[model samples]
Target: MFKQIVFLKRNRIRKKSKLVKQVLLLSFDFTSLFYTLLVIGYFVIAIVMEGNIRNNIQDKIISIEAYTVEQFWVILTAIPIIYIIRSFNQPGVIFSTAEYTLTFLPNTLQQVWRVVAIERWIKSGITYLIGGIIIYILSPTSASIVLLYIFILIGLNVLMTLPEWKLFQQHLWLKIVVLISLILINLVNLYLKSSFLSILFIAILFLINVLLLPRTFQQIDWKKVTAASDFKIWNMVMISYVTKIKYRKERQYSIWQRLSFWKKPFLYKKSVGYNRLWHLYFEKNIGVCLKLIGALFLLLFLILFIKEELFFLAIAFTIHSSSTVAASLFNDRLRTDLVQMLPWDLTLFKQTILKWIYSTSALLLLPIIMFIFRDLSVWTLIHVLAMIFSFLFLMPIKIEKVFKKFDNKASDFKWTEIFCYILILLIIISNIYLEFLIGVCLMMGIIPILKKAEK
Candidate 1:
């Protein structure tokens, strides 16, 4: 029976292995390993040239206190990243035959113990090897000292996982309580002076984690566990990609159609001249602006609430703004085609784009202003007025000339777009540093130029 179970599990693994390979092909660049090697090579070259400069800085700033703090920070930061990577890989075990073998085996407890032992061994071995390499590189210490530290770090990481693992499978409230307690302890540790007592407290926490591991392992429903693990892997690989594709398609259509709806209230009949032109523009690209507005608001809410981290907020904003801007440019490519067909000159195109920009910006900014301040401030009122003037007068003329002169295609990373993005970054940073008025003025100035360029 045991042998048959093992054989079936092996067959399952062979089937899933092919699926995993397909997932890898779809999800990641095949040349990622080559790219990683190239990046490592560059890092090594940079380190070789700059190592002396770093050494000099270290020499100047060297202190036992600083060194200790730095070491602690490195260890603390590493623990989470390592833990996540380890967890990501371990989901593979759920898809394996061992789970089934354990389920059908007469000595269920014994089979579970065997699986637990093997898992612990693999986890510990991999953690130690990686941790040792990192420590050796960073400190260039003797193997004995590195090995000692590696064991300590690995024990700490594994222990950290136990309470969470147990809680994840059992009572969620208990897990939350434990998590809160751990966070509180970390906070206390941060604010309080280092002492033997504090160290002892931390050691006890580690001990509790280690004690929970066997219990956590014993709680696992082997059959359910195997199925869940397989489902998780497949869900991540197939479901996530499919969901993303569906979301993109929906977003594109929603944005485009929403904008077009306003222009053509009654769609059945053919229109003429300016009406026809307006209809064509509306049908072709109105969705682009609507999409941008939706996206901007989405980002605003996400940054304002979802992520408290400043770095992530900055990254999100950059990506959100740049992609939206690129989409706007791509939409403009169709407008360029319309421009060739229209009796109106390039100036008319510039005016049309400026009007679109002004209307869209007004729609986008109103919600933000309303949300941030219940009553509009005098400065904000003036800023809005300035933006209107700039969009109508300054931006249209300047942007149209630039676009006509350059005639550059939209790309993932165009130099022109990069410059615009840098300007946007500067504006955001300036908003952080300067008065709101200055930031408003800077934004107002850019609007006209952007509008003109669309022409």
Candidate 2:
């Protein structure tokens, strides 16, 4: 039974690896593929011409100082911290079909649980070990630093798995506190003197966490955890897209309860017509809108207060917002059967979309007011207006077409969607006025398609 389970796991891994490679190869169009090969070829020629890559790399690395050791730890620590925080709500640990297969196998429940915990620890340790090794090479310091890296890695793995124990799963504040404490402990370790006692303390902490593993496993609501982690709809859909394997949930699961924060009363007293429609959707999915708004606001703040020249990058962000907002707006609507049941006017739908897109694009204008308040240039004004027009006039058509694709139950993403933005980027970098003309013409061409799709 163990051998069979191992074989199944290996097979699944191989299939997933093959599927990812195929999707990547197919995702590249001629233009992207050519550039990709060109870049690879250029790098290959450069490396061949350089004679000895290892020696060159060694020469480059010789100038580094011990201060960089601190920086290395910061970079390595920041990534997993962010990842754990982001996924705090969801414990995405997956075990194989051991629950079902257990009945037929000789392995007891405790044995299976131990196997799961050991497997998880090994996986986590491998990831941390790789990162620690790279950092050790990059910023060699006291031998104690190596020990510190090892302890930090194991400590994080323990902290991350604490959710499985159900101690902090539902307690948001408690989770935050524990995470902060773990971080503080790691930081303090960096300053500690190199000693056998310090190393032993780290080892003891790790062992205690290890000792807690069996209880963690026993305490877990295995059925619930497995159900939630095993067959997420989005994960299945993504894998199916790449692999052409229609993976479905083994057991039925209901949607999670809607968040209560957005359940406030409608914006207006008498919610009628479009007001009602917008309120219903927006209130239910306000988180998406808020996230996008916050990101754009941050960009605006940075460009205005911190660095003015970052406005160039801000323009790209503003352009990207069209796609982001469009996705958020259409995600639920396309799946909603009631939308098709209504006597919806095609023209009204288009106008409503245009209104929303324009309103969203207006947020991008806030940064330009800073320029106007200080010392404004005609070119800045022109560039801003052209981008606004592109978002208002051109982006809606692209968004509407995206809606049509969704309505038709086609693929969720397309290569052309990416290439279109690439084209616009090149044109904008060359000349804004020319981009405006091109945007106008593209809008004209897409209008008929939008109308047809809407109907």
RMSD of 1: 14.3
**Which regions in candidate 1 have their CA more than 4 angstroms from the true location?**
1-17, 20-98, 107-110, 134-145, 157-162, 193-198, 206-228, 231-455
lDDT of 2 by residue, 324-420 (tens): 6675576456456566466555445556655665675565565566555555775555556655544544465555565555357533234444444
In model 1, the Cα lDDT at residue 214 comes to 60
Best by TM-score: 2
> Using alpha carbons, what is the TM-score of model 2?
0.45
lDDT of each: 0.50, 0.56
lDDT against true structure, model 2: 0.56
